[model samples]
Target: MSTTHEVTNQVPPLVGHDVAEDPALLEALRREGAGWAEPELHEVGRLAGSEQAQEWGRVVNENEPVLRTHDRYGNRIDEVEFHPYWHSLMDVAVEHGLHGAPWADSTPGAHVARAAKLFVWGQVEAGHTCPISMTYAVIPTLRANPELAAQYEPLLTAKTYDFGLRVPTSKQGLIAGMSMTEKQGGSDVRANTTRATPAGDGTYRLVGHKWFTSAPMSDIFATLAQAPGGLTCFLLPRVLPDGTRNRMHIQRLKDKLGNRSNASAELEYDEAVGWRLGEEGEGVKVILRMVNNTRLDCLLGSAAGMRFGAVQAIRHARHRSAFGSVLVEKPLMRNVLADLVVESEAATVVAMRLAGATDRGEEILRRIGLAVSKYWVCKRAPVHAAEALECFGGNGYIEDSGMPRLYREAPLQSIWEGSGNVAALDALRAMARQPETVEAFFTEVERASGADARLDDAIEGLRKELSNLEDMEFRARRVVESMAMVLQGSLLVQHGAPSVADAFCASRFAGDWGVALGTLPSGVDTKAIIERALV
Candidate 1:
């Protein structure tokens, strides 16, 4: 055979570089009082960037989870079968305290540290993080019932990864899932028609169908049903006490757009025994705690995707030759790569700031700021991923390049907790009901005063937009997007490198940007911004 088809001009695999070598993330970690965790953060970062870990991400996605709804004897046995690599990913995540462990830690910056770890590990595979995020989110909601929290909190936060259908209490650790959406009431949990009847002995029997229940293989679930008082939150175990399975029935696993390594099932509860969490008629209030934590994950996940995409594009541009020059050296390609780097840095900055809010117990900011970031950052992920993938030209379009996987996973976080409209409205509602949250939001935004003139102007514009409640409902998306960018600008000005900050403000706030990604105005130090994307 002729050796005529030897591959040339092919970009080498992106491996060995520490994924946690992200300057923005490390700076934010040190700035947020979690500098002590830096050693472990790099450890996780190294593992995440290893060729083995990257292969794990690829294998699991290519081999999607399969639903095993019955046994050979035709008995109904609800289960999801995943590739063994799924367990490997989940094992590292739990051991690193990226799941529920941070809630149990007494350290000042425990949550911030965990946030950094999750950001690093999630780049390995985003799908498995669904369960990890749910486990972390459920711990806070479980506290609504002290007794329930006492029983399961230990297992939820345990480092051991116990994967099975055994009784949750018997396991050394447990993974948690959220089963809230119904066929009819997607985000409107109050409209859920699932009914729950008190079973005389401190338990309730639930009867309903959940349209989307992710991580169905997990042992425990935080679900919502209509109690007699009103819609209420409940904790349902896949395996009940005395080694018996609950009445929870798996209807079928959903065929989703992405996140294939994770299982999302349509489920039915036929008088499933569950214990009520919090008071009756307060399900929405109780479950919102979990939603808040998970929304933070949504922001972090989006930021990670951006970082992954930017780094990949830059890595490709550095080595690949195009039009008689390397892509990174080309003027237009340099601008585009720098733009992606700036966006990724901005996202990491805001994400760490929000995680810092959680660590410091800044409830007001976490409540409102989270909604705004969830609305804007998650929405930006898909567009950012698309631009990053295009940097590789036709190579990025193919599945083997792994750019397609990043592109596929980009849009998931936006639709996970609440879609675009739901998130925007939530922020507006928070501002109307809890006025202090608005004060908290602005207070945080004002910290970067005198840092960037365009940011200052944008803040004033946002204030004017929020001042008028007239037609606010119609302008909810507009208001939230403005708030999101202003907050990102403020954080970048205060915490990010001057090059990243200057480029971000120039392109994002000064109106110098265009509809596409590479449209950064000239003189924006593209080389400095692009350099930060490398190890």
Candidate 2:
């Protein structure tokens, strides 16, 4: 038998016309819009009572599960075993979503925001690594290892009333990080030098130092390595089968500019026991999925930071009396406040659209949405933060005042979870696979934008911008800009319209108003009936 098999897989070329023209989907989107402004947040808090805030506040008040405190010479302070605040928050988050808690949709995204703010408050604002670990390390491990699930199910499922980081937080766990960035090599996972060799007895040995492992103290490490086939992922347990220490050695923790508190470790793997995830050459594929989810986290974090910074500036502007009036009273400062609102809300809306795509089980769409949302929000965080900080004047530069932390942490947004460049490349690749999706995305926006007076002008402005996308260079620019436009339209129609007609409106927007129809050379409204809900 041949070890190599030619797998001719068809992705069924996705066209923007199909989704943009989905009448039913648009109708559903329109119907969903009526309740767009429905006070889900207050309602959830009121219904859940202290339970909602209590669980969430733990993440806000306490430090996360993994802590990275270093000494004078940059030596890592060995695991201090802080109370498990981050874990408690995760427990609450899982329960909230599982039971369809009132703010279920909002809770996950909101909790992420709360976690980022809390990190900001602790001055360890830079140590925002738990969210990625929870998604990449914790969730995937639970899916792969039922034994571990059996051990931790209670924690993951149980409803907790207590607040702050809980203690005695022990469970079969997995922690994930990256090693793609090397001294010579960049984030090209395909070029990773980490090697793993089968050690017989269903175990394998991993040898090679990874450049960066975010949460170093995790019991299991979802580390990537290279083999005879191609890039692959391994469940590198921190301990051996006998529960003794494995050869997974930590060389040193990185002294990064921001996210300083999240100890990013450089690891040396010496014949570590590792279980293969999927096929030997398929690690990149599996990890890419995991990374997409992380990108969502990154967007959520960027939004949270923007929200926090905005909140800080608003508070100061309203309270601080400058030039005989509050900072917010000055027209210039007020304009800054308005800018913060727009930027922050824009990011929030994009994040929400990505979340909605995920909730709807559109995995392909979800990846694109996640990529765009991450790029958009993370890119805008610095802009919003700097503006907010400028409003603070000299106070923004002071460390104790909180503005400086946001300034310091804002840049990290563009660096993590597949940086902006990486995200751009991946997004382009996805668009190439589903060329029509780009068009569908925009057409829906145009349809929605044409209807809404508040958004029509902006939509029209964007339309003119895309008109230049006729030639190859223009098409290149159009692809990126068009991606953003579709996302904006999706968000506006998804969240801005009235709730009762959410589905309808969204479908209509997709079909007649989207950029997909305008941009695709071979345009076809495949889902027009669904978009119109005419059937």
Candidate 3:
């Protein structure tokens, strides 16, 4: 394999190197890593057997004849006109849309949906990084400047292709919304000082700089600016209303850690024509809703990348023996690999459930679920990938080994699309508002599991513990823990693909406990206790 990808100038995004070697620290890491355990292959077999899934798989595989030739980045040779793999994803996306892609497939929770989302992300990871998915952002941004909407109306239909006008809304085009992360501001759209002024009849002049614009060439952008009421979303077309120059300038492409295939750039929008997305102050709200897809996308993409890294590590460890034995045969390595596989599955479950809920139009549930899943899995990804990389010994440290790309990319998952801290805060706030929403959320979770009696006992016990706590910090922590439990248990029950009886049982179990738990105090500890009981 080629080692052409550079690593310098790009600091590894993880904090504290070699922390895994510390005995006390390693134990905690080990414990956290074990949360995602290897389940029976049967859990995944349903997806493998799903006719829709199999068909999508065939789409990817059929294109493999072409895909194999390119690097993970979609950099093709001079002779190659177009990578057929692009369309492979479109088929799956349309299929997913038709079959309720991520949510309604009955393949067990959200893993399949996450798998689909990640599949799209991998293409972006391979080389399609543009934050153009901000199509939702345009609605609010254009609300204030609807006059220019006609110019970019074609871009809204997802038919964008080739980075210019008459763009086909190909699978690759969905990446357009990634442009928000310029040097100016990403999640903190309020911080962006990028200015836009009216240039007479409905045309506005734009002036500012941004860093980390994922796809500079995407057809549309869900970018931000300081409008009269507050920060807002804007719809900027790559071309003018008359198909002339739009005046949005690209400064330079950024050199990134991973996801190199999608280039990041410093951008300068100079006297660029502009259209707004929603009402003035509504820009922030609209952008958040629009880019929520990217947040979920980030969560699943990073998780899938972690999964790919683990499989590679396992394959390498199995083939490359040390101490005169295959790595799998060693007790220590076996333990490591076992934990890695299961946790990856667990992460998939968390990510997919959120995707399914969102796909099903369960807005509030989707918001909380996606936020929680993104926070947990994005943070968890590197820990597993790093361990899997360690199994490669010295090979893991080298770019040729492929572990480093994942390691580098892992940190970005948490940082992008609102940091983990932001997501956690948002989640707690949401729970506080609809205290019952959390209960309803968990009820759905419990119903999926058919009443794990121990879980009920554990939650009841935790309720007592939480009821004793008057401290706000402790209460806050408990809320997170409770949410985590519902998320995990709900996903396992709903999507676990157990026998019909088992599914029925899990549902009943979850449904009863969910209602019971909701009736109790907010400071519940059932999930933590249940987790402890399992240990």
Distance from true location, Cα of 342 in model 3, Å: 1.5
TM-scores for all candidates: the values are 0.99, 0.68, 0.66
- Per-candidate count of clashing residue pairs (backbone under 3 Å): 0, 63, 59
Best by TM-score: 1
Model 1 per-residue lDDT at 277: 92
What does candidate 3's lDDT look like per residue over 1-535, in tens digits?
Answer: 4568754322222211221121211122222232121132222323323444324433432232111223457642111122344344333333233111222234433333333433333422333322333343333333445554444443343333333343333323332343465454555667788776766675456678877665565565667776666666677766554656566666555666655544456667777777766666676677666557767666666656655555555566556667887665665555455445444545555665565565456777776777667777776676777877787788789865556666776777777777866767767667667676566565655564435554455455545644554664435545554555556544544443232123223333244323211122222332321121110
lDDT agreement with native, every candidate: 0.92, 0.51, 0.50
Question: Residue 222 CA error for candidate 3 (Å)?
Answer: 1.3
Task: Specify the highest-lDDT model's number.
Answer: 1
lDDT of 3 at 278: 68
The C-alpha local distance difference test score for the whole of candidate 1 amounts to 0.92
| Model 1 per-residue lDDT at 491 | 92
